[model samples]
Target chain A: MPGNRWALRYCGNMLSLTIKEVSLALREGKISPLELCRKCLKRIKKTQHLNAYITVTEELALKQAEEAESRLLQGVYQGILDGIPFAVKDNFCTENIRTTCASRMLKDFLPPYNATVVQKLLDQGAVLVGKTNMDEFAMGSGSTDGVFGPVRNPWSYAAPYREQSGGAEDDSEWVITGGSSGGSGAAVTSLTSFLALGSDTGGSTRNPGALCGAVALKPTYGLLSRHGLIPLVNSMDVPGIVTRSTSDAAIVLEVLQGRDLKDSTTVQSPTSHAGFSEDFDVRNLCVGIPKEYHAPGLSQETLAQWSRLADLLEGAGARVREVSLPHTQHSIVCYHVLCCAEVASNMARFDGLEYGHRSTEDSSTDAMYAASRHEGFNAVVRGRILSGNFFLLQQNYERYFLKAQQVRRLIAEDFEHAFSAGVDVLLTPTTLSDAASYSHFIQADNRTRSTQEDVFTQPANLAGLPAVSVPTALSSRGLPIGLQLIGPAFQDGMLLSVAHWIEQRVGFPSISNYEVPNK
Target chain B: MLGIHQIYGRRRVQLNIILPLLCRYYYASRTDNMLSTNVKTLRKTRNTPSRPVTVARLYSSNKHNSKVPKVPTWEPLGEDRIPSLPQVSSDLVDKLERLALVDFRTKEGLVCLERAIRFADHLNMVDTTGVEPMDSVLEHGQLFLRGDTVTEGDCAEKLLPLSNTTVEEYFVAPPGNIPLPRREERASMLKHSEF
Candidate 1:
């Protein structure tokens, strides 16, 4: 009601509004939360061909929107996000809502309790739009491995080609929405939802956000609570935020960050809120460019854009220097060892005899367990489990698992030393290249491809550092290419502030031209 | 003479029951052709009305009415698509299955196992020594264990409905061949074994 006296002026439709704009509209009585929900639902229905959502919580969304409208009318609105509609990746449990982590094992598993983050958002009057799809068990770099089917990148949908010769080929390839949080990225990119939550473990959130042209933040480990967030790699897992801009990501991060009794990994005291102003001074900021990150697989377009961004920052009085993170070369291998080892331990609980899908085999308990898991999990998940079990074995434990852990510490220390030496933030490419075609992506093995995809992103997770993917340029094929900015642990505010400055200067083009009706 | 006749009749009936069971047990353990034939013969004679025993199935399937989805087909990739690595032997796969409680015997499972081994080969290239392994991401915090208290009180009644095999107040599992000692069986065998 504070902004209600302002003149209510909105564009033709609500789909173009950001979360901040939507909240302002709600407060100014330009549109009711119910109206906003209905518009979003319509957009979602229109974009069904994208396959971004596994379950659309239509009824629940309408109910919450009604509550928000009533609160607004009573002059007791919650905050800026009071009536915002958003989606979360299906991995997070919602009370009585089906949370299938894109695997058949949890296809029908309904959690009896809500994840702490979901409860926090709902308490702030954020309307739950639906649950988006992802890579099964968050194990792959592409979202094609989901049981519900793959999510197509909204930016990569090319129109049917007309042939001069008489024979026509159908769209031979569909562009992949990078995973395992691809659906959430696609949802926000296509303007089907105002915002969405993606869980980042080794770039699950940033990869998709980069490909889909959205802002994704993987906050520093322990800065945000991880309770009830179905773990992929518990030590590196953090709930990430996906939005159209850096400010929205920061706002949502504020709403979600806290110290929780249920999660022991959180900071002892609540960190300060992520507040940033347009006038936040970024002059003379020291930006590090890790020389090792300029690897062999990086594309020419991405490299050019990365260089251009550095020049822009330098022109704005920031010192862009090539800083050496010596351990960067081994981070990916170290990440794989730790990720698999942790996955082996975390996935043991889904033996099908407990909360997930059970096998029909009654032969023996052991046989039943094997059969259930074999039938429930996909190839990607099964591969990780096998590799994890091997690394954690007593015979190989010292050689593989223990050594990887030591290397992991070195990687974290590298970031610590770099930050301690007055490097304000480290700038790198979010991914090796732009989004690949489904045909090209599946050509390689899932593990190999995933490792390649996470090369630039996983180090942030391994070091327990905060990182964000900001879309900076377009590739020749017209796909979005994102650059990453990572800061020291618990320095998320400074990291995001510099990212915000870059975002305003770049003013990158979004994916609006590809919203064609499904043929 | 009359008592002997009655005893012989009882012995004949007992033999009829024990003979089929013995054949089944032998058939299960042995790969001999003659033993398998004997099992078949016993099974054929099992339907005779003289020894009436009914085996009822609590679960039945309506397979005819249910429609099973077809498996998706995809174009196969050439050998070059898959990077060659140290091949995991079948024995190693079996060990992995035992450790993971997941099968890798099927086609898809085998493919997954091969891919995993290939990924492991990549991790093997790194050299690490004297570095402490970080089991957790916590920099300076120690594990905080909660006080021993009843956080989750009795929720058996709420949880019973979650499974399909709930009977009365207990969740039931399919009875298997493994002979687990039950509470009633323990009470009955108290005299034979030390408590």
Candidate 2:
């Protein structure tokens, strides 16, 4: 069986090329975008059991690819990303395509327009491969909470992509793809998409990417326009990039980050692009090791990888020192309060009226609203709304919501202090441990599991700092471990350069380069 | 929500039901209003039991919108310092249903609210003395506002189709309380007499 698994790895290399490799091939006229799009579509169909995608835009993808192919052949390409096949997390609205947010509420929701990011990619001639699956309303730590079923990690031990033994039940005892951006993470790592857009409200993108062995990036807040990316936590939400390598992530981020009139929260002034030159150096870097990130429940394997990277950085002529962010202990709790409050506020918009699930069997307007929400949303999403509403309550507003905001200020200030004190970037573990199995992941409640899993990632979202999860190495269990590098606000380029340096030194294994059997 | 029926006992539930009907009857007879009369008449002559009727909920939207929860007294743990749990109640659950519009009186919803409050109680341990609340991380830079000039308009034809229920020119919705119908009932009624 192991031999067969290895033999199957040789079935294709066309699906496994990175965005940079794919771009070179396209430019050299060795591979047409249409051919690549067809292969991507075929790969998606082959991996349908993984449940990584909610809607595969085969027809539209082919149409876009053909147009790109024509432009490429005619030597009138729009840009470097012209004809690159990429996927968008289902949360981003795609004009005339279903954007479910992986919730039953939007099971049939087709948006009237595309998200700003989606439109930008399309305008640049990037082919829209499909919309990836995610937690319902991007709310869970494990993608299992998504209505479409869990996005199984390609590297999970329950082999051949964690096919359920029960067949019908999605609750198989397999390793989880950390979420709420689990599907986007799965898509990139599994070679289903070259690049995928994942929204990082908390640790949604990094959590999943770390578990799935993909580089996940959350740019500084407002670096990317949030226009059509459905709001999870309006302020914390940023469109994250998922790719096999740091450079691929940097290339994608360069295209996606910009201001627009559609998203008011976009950074008003033009910010620096996250592109680093080929001669990037680590000598000038001052890396901070946040002592607060040695959080409880952090696995020894994860700590060893983090420390190993710190040693490597120090040995490579970069200064590494311990920095303390005292408010870190209180961040997870602060995140829950602020995140839930925003969730309740954003969810109030979905009442079975404006472009979502509508329950026709109900009589009263209130009944319809209640029935639609109850049926459309999963327990995780509904629970957040209820609790969020509790915080936003007139009486509790002062204690929960207001206090949370004040703590949020302190949290952001901690990052400000660390960055101002001459820390070019902070190094930490992306997740507490390697991916946990579905059986163990579900042992705790969604709220507790999310809190524990998202502890490291959430603080970055709260501080509105740019952070990236670079896949460091394989754990003893053969699952991937990722290390996070968080930079000061708008210093995304410097952060990527450091990440690229680490990525080169670590040389984490991507599926594309995995050794096949009988070579 | 079952309205007063959920809160009141069986004996009091009957009186609670009659009181709303009486108020509707009073509003129905007021000659200045006709559309309100139709809604009242629909409830008045219906043969079915008023089990699913929500006459009281129209005003319930604002009933407890301003009610605040009493903050629990915080106590330090034995050296480890785990924040003590916040006290959760059925009244809080009731308000959640009213405000969020989800049925939180269920076992799952109820458990979630209680657990979330317990998690949120962690904030009480921190000394957030003189910190001003940061509403948005974008507070350092102002939001880039566009001119007030019309950027998008005249797309009612495109917008109305997104909803499942739409009239000739507009989306069909229960405007505030009474669900507005397709075409003005009186205008159509005056145009053609029903059998």
lDDT values of the candidates? 0.74, 0.76
The candidates' DockQ values read 0.10, 0.15
lDDT digits (tens) for residues A94-181 of candidate 2: 9999989988788888788999998988888899999999889999989989888888777653222221122213435557899999
lDDT of 1 at A271: 45
Quality of model 2 by C-alpha lDDT: 0.76
Model number with the top TM-score: 2
- Residue A24 displacement (Å), model 1: 0.9
Top lDDT hit: 2
Expressed as tens digits, the lDDT of each residue in B68-140 for candidate 2 is: 1111112222323545656667566555676776665357667777778877877888898888999888886
Per-candidate TM equals: 0.81, 0.82
